[model samples]
Structures are given as C-alpha cells and as structure tokens.
Target: MRLEGRTAVITGGTRGLGRAIAEAFLAEGASVVAAARNPYDIKELADDHEGRLLYQYTDVTDERSVEELMTAACEAYGGVDILVNNAGVSRDGKIARLSVADWNTTLATNLTGVFLCTRAVIGPMTTPGKPAGPGGRIINVSSCVAGRAAVGAGAYSASKAAVEMFTRTSAVELAPKNIRVNCLSPGYIDEGMGKELAANERAWESYRGRLLSDRLGRPEEVGAAAVFLAGGESSYVNGTVVEVNGGLLWAA
Candidate 1:
C-alpha cells in the first residue's frame, strides 16, 4: 500500500484513464474523490472495492465548480495529497477549416481546466493541519501530441503543450512548499483519448507495426505510472515530463 491513508482527487475520474487511476489509488490504500460532469454509478464501484470513494459532479473549466470540488474533497477526506488533472477533449479538423469556437473550447477544457483544478487544490495541499503526507503530488495528464507537430490536431496539440509548460512552472513554484508537479504524456494509448484511433481495425494493424511494443498501451498502464508519480517512489522527480509512449514518440 504505497499510498496508505492518502487522499486524492482526480478530475474526469468517471471514465477512461481517470477511472483507472481512481481504481489504482484505491487499491494502493488511498481514499479518492472522483470528480467529473457525469454522475457516477457509485453503488457498483463501491461494491467492487471495499474502500472509500466519493464522486462529485464537476465542470473543471469553471472556477466555482472546481473550488466546490476541493472543499468537498478536503472536508470528506481531511486533505488532498494528490491531484491528477485528466479532464480533456479533442476536436479534429484542418487548420483552414477549423472553427474558432471549437479551438477555444478545446483550450478551455484541456488547458484551462487544469489551471482551475490545480488552483483550487493547491491551498489544501500546502496548508497545515491537513493529513495527506509529508509532501504533495500534482500530475497533469498531457499527450504525446504536445511534442509532435502532428497534422489535423492543432488546437488539441497546442493545449497539451501549454499544459506541459504550465507543469514546469508549477514544479518550480511549488518546490519550496514540498509539492512536486510533473506531466504524463502518453502516446497512442489503446483506451481513453486514443479510443477513436484504436477503434479502426486497419489503423490498429498499421499502428502496431510502428510501435516498439507492437501494440497500443492500456489505460491501466497509465494508471500504474500515475501511482508511481503520486507515491514516495518519485520523491526527487520534479519539473519533468514522463513519456509513457512505449517508444512511439522516441523524439520526445
């Protein structure tokens, strides 16, 4: 139980990578606060695991909503020890044909959401009388597209890139407070953000040949890496980007 007695909040934890992270944390003995817009089916999940889990409907893009999420999490769990910013979206279109509304929306949810969640939780992570741990962890879930100038994903890519920069900035600022900030940028994962690409059988076959692992990574693998970042294993690791791309983005 690497995270025994820790309290964690994961945005977008109702599904995909976020959901997997919540499960992983719970398995590691952490009490989790899962926040997302979707109302969670708590009964089924609670039955599956004999551990503590709370869900709050949250729009991460909204400051007030994010603040309320933090308040509820801290009140319920005592304090926040780890935060995983995993709320994001994608809108694919050519640059010439892209709509400003779509671009702004992507930035709002992907980038601004991270900022809102981080800001809302930072105080609890830093303030005293909170029983989280000796230090705190903030892991921003980014994408491999942030490192590559791939075609047809300008808005999504740029938003993720900005998130990385934000991560570095947060690490530098929060270091004095004993909180570490890092980014996890996965490449062509089989579940979560890459589901659309993986849904195409032909695309998976072609993609398998390119990947060093000969297959797309799974959401649980990302969850495992996230656990490492959140636990004491990554104590000295700070202001860095962990590439969970399975050699697909060797350039990163």
Candidate 2:
C-alpha cells in the first residue's frame, strides 16, 4: 500500500473525480476524510470501507469551515498526511457579458477555496510544527482551459490559471519543509456536470474533433493520477501539473 498509514483530506469529495480519488486513497490503505458542503452518502462509503473513512460537511469558501475540516481530520487520525483541494465551480460567460457575481463565485470556489484549505492544513502537515509525521502532500485540481482561451470560459479559465500559479508558488515555499504541492489539470472529462453544455450530438461532434484523444476522459483516469501523485512514488515531484486529459492538450 502506497499510503499505508496516511490520512487524506479531500475537498469536494462527495462526487465525481473527488469521490473517485477518495476511494482510491482508501484502497491504498489511507484513512480518508471526505469533505463537501452537502451531506454525502456516508453510509454507503462507510459500509464498504468501514473505519478507514470519514465525511465532513465543509464549505471551502469560508475560512472557519475550512479550518474546522482540518481540525476534524487531525482529531480523527492524529494529523493530515495528504490534502486534495478539489472543490471548484464554473460560471461560463463571455467576459463582456459576465456579471461580477459570476466572476466572484468562480474565483472564490476555485482559487480562494484552495488557498483556505491549504492554509488550514499547512501547520499540521509540515515538519516545523506540531504535526504527527514528517511532512505531507497537496494536490490542486486545475483545468486545461486555464492556459487555453475558450470562448465562453473567461471566468473559469482565469480562476484555474490562478490555481496553477498558486500551486507553483506554494510548492516552492513549502518544499523546504518537505511538503509537496502539485496540480492536476483534466480536460474534456466525461461527466454529467458538463453534459448540459454539450447536450446535442452536433455540439459534441464539433467538440470531439478538437481533442487529440478519440474519447472523453474517464473520471477514474484522473483518480489514478491523483493516487500516484499522493503516494510516496512521487516523492521527488513538486510544483508539477500532471495533465490527465488523454493527450488532448499535450503542450499546454
């Protein structure tokens, strides 16, 4: 088991890629604390994983709630060994037509939330503090659109771009303390959340041509990358953005 005695805190872990990552961690023998705003199907997760899992209702946009999430994880497993800041939202609109609320909401959840969650866990995850183990890990979920100029994704692109930058800066700052930080940017993932945008066959066909990969990426593929990055196999890796887009945005 790559994470035999680790404890992981994953934000936005109720569903989708986050849920898949949480399960992957559990499979690797890590105790996981999955956090989101809404109550989750903990009974099901608990039934499968038993004492190795926990669920917390966390609002990443709020500092107090984020702190509470980290505190709960420490209380449960002594300290956090891994932190996944994966909570994000998209507000799609052209820059000229975008409202302030739309931009703020996107930035808050995608960029600011990551900062809050990282800050909440840094003291406990680093070496020069009252921590359980030596050091810990951090993974920020980014997007391929961050560097790409998508027409209707101004707010989302900007927010993810911030996430990427923050990932690099945080990694550099935390490296001395033995804490690793990295980013995972996924592209054209086959998930229900974006189904409404490409609802029609014609729209999907048009979008499909742009992708180098023939099919959309599966959620499990992203989860696999997360597992690798969160594990000891990636000890020398830091400030890197692992693209799990099936080679769609190769250069970016």
1-252 per-residue lDDT for model 1 (tens digits): 999889899998878888889889988999988899995575567567655888888998899999999999888878889999999989989899989999999999999999998888889898776644669999999998898887899999999999999999999998888899999988888785578787888967776666787678898889999999999999989999998888886522
Once fitted onto the true fold, the runs of candidate 1 whose alpha carbons sit more than 4 angstroms away are: 40-42
**Residue 198 displacement (Å), model 2:** 5.9
For candidate 1, the per-residue lDDT at 130 reads 60
TM values, all candidates: 0.94, 0.93
- Cα lDDT tens digits, model 2, 1-252, are 888899999999878788888888888899999999864675598679888889999999999999899889988988889999999998889989999999999999999999999888887686355544536899999998888898989999999999999999999998877899999998878775545535778878877766777678888888889989998789888999998876766533
Q: Score candidate 1 by lDDT.
A: 0.88
In model 2, which regions exceed 4 Å deviation?
A: 127-134, 194-199, 250-252
- On TM-score, the leading prediction is 1
